[model samples]
Target: MGNKTALYDKHQEMGAKLVDFGGWDMPIHYGSQVDEHHKVRQEAGMFDVSHMTVVDVTGTDAKEYLRYLLANDVAKLQQKGKAMYSGMLNEDAGVIDDLIVYLMTEPGVAGEWFRVVVNCATREKDLRWMSDQTASFDDVALTEQPDLAMVAVQGPKALELAKQSVSESRATLIDQLSVFQGLESEGWFIARTGYTGEDGLEIMLPEDEVADFWQALADAGVSPCGLGARDTLRLEAGMNLYGADMDETVSPLAANMGWTIAWEPQERIFIGREALQAKKEAGISEKLVGLVMESRGVLRAHQKVVVSGVGEGEITSGTFSPTLGCAIAMARVPSATADQAEVDIRGKLVPVRVIRPSFVRNGKKVFD
Candidate 1:
């Protein structure tokens, strides 16, 4: 009896194994999650990401408001359709959420708009925070776009085959999209973005038109994947899982997300700036890094990690990497941790290798 997306029926029709995700009944997998994972790496796959919250921001003060709201500077977005990834923080410098914001319109355009996509589970608090911050800006407005449904088409042939599923003109538009840019056409927002660590597009269109589009992609030979594959794929790509890797209690500095924080210009005071500055001055004691247990067993979240004498840490997200054919994990460990560590697996302390936080990219091992 959880909330359902507009594509819920379609997922059921395709024999998806539905599970509760962020209060929504979502497909965990259609069949054989490992097989589906390989499909996306080898060819193309489509996922129903309609449950993600999309909010549109506009008005005269929109730009200024965003600059103050996110840790990253939006002033760097020079042109329309460009997108940036950022984290919203509380006054204490804890990560509220990680999101992507797209500059919807350029300067002097009719409507200076920005679109933000946040996690489905954190929508309520995220919206509340966004609106509360807007109270200082009289002209700013936030519009929740529940009428839109999103689908992420991904893999090596993702763009090429997905283009054939849409109109010829839309196909041409897709070809023009760069890595992180997005554009609107015929009421649909097509963005060159994805979570699978592969080249792909996330298309937001009217909910009514989504079923037809999804079916067309299936006709074009794109496989229908589910959350199980999605999680493993993103993990292989070294992307952080919200609740597992970070939450309201964790700072971005400890979550391997320090790169997302923009600390320049000194004057741009966003929420959590003061606290994050103090933390930077104090030094980060722990860090998020990649763990490789290539021997036999799989690594999982909540497993205790021992860094010999430094201290203990815990795995945030871990699994058997289908692409790498080995077990990999992201763990928060003592900053002093180096090449070797041990993970407590089933009361047995198993040795592991510590490396950079990424494992695979473009179907190959990336970490040294």
Candidate 2:
């Protein structure tokens, strides 16, 4: 037996195929993974994301503490509810984890608060690392919000359909939120964010109310999606998976996350600054890129990529893109590699085109 979310029974009731995901028994699919994937792309689908860890950082020194903890500068968040994606790094410029931090209070305000959502698999290590770092800061406090359950409603009609499940007041708030922004109403926090590269809301509310809320969404015509579809959707969107694309051993720069680093205000000084600065000076030897297999056969992780005259690399994440009707992958290869490469599948060398990692956005293909 594994840990189960508040909606575990609901998933089983819907005939979901349950599997162990990072110690949690999660739904892989209700029936057909492809159908669930298409439902999100064509209409609305909801996913139980309560397995993700949510932590609240509060107190007078909260802002200062986060500025030192994340590679991205939280000082750039000028408004409350604004969210920023960042990479928490180690002293050696290696990625500890990638997360989203929401500024919960107004800028330059006392009693400042911030909400951080981290990968469930890295929850223990991340909490320990955060605790050790905050030991020296007496004014800041960290509290894990285990009482909250999160649900992601996504796709073209996600916002409209999700609104039917909440109150009219909450619906209005959800309609007004901009991309990457969030707002709290009636004890529920709704954010205009999603993993599917589609317009959606990730709502966090009291755990006890989640089952009823999920049932309401289902009644409102929102399809119940599972982890299998979630993986394919995020892969098509070119989002990095925690353990597959990068880990404690890999730097953000090599994981296509260099853009997440805030280099200005040189004095802000966050963890891994020294090592990142040194890497910048020395020049990065490898980088993450997108691979398109127009040829037959599927792409899978750990597949060897040969860049003609350049050195070899490996596929970090790969899948058959439902939207593109082809296989796509993200790979770490020699920085000098050009637009062409060959993926070693089994014993055969298959030609592939290298491009930017993002293959789709807003339900449309972004690559040529």
Per-residue error for 247 in candidate 1, Å, reads 1.0
* lDDT value, residue 244 of candidate 1: 91
Candidate 1 residue-wise lDDT, 7-38, digit = tens: 88889999999999999999999988999999
- Runs off by more than 4 Å, candidate 2: none
Please tell me which predicted candidate would have the highest lDDT against the true structure: 2
Error of 1 at 89 (Å): 0.3
TM-score of every prediction relative to native: 0.98, 0.99
lDDT of 1: 0.92
lDDT of model 1 at residue 364?
75
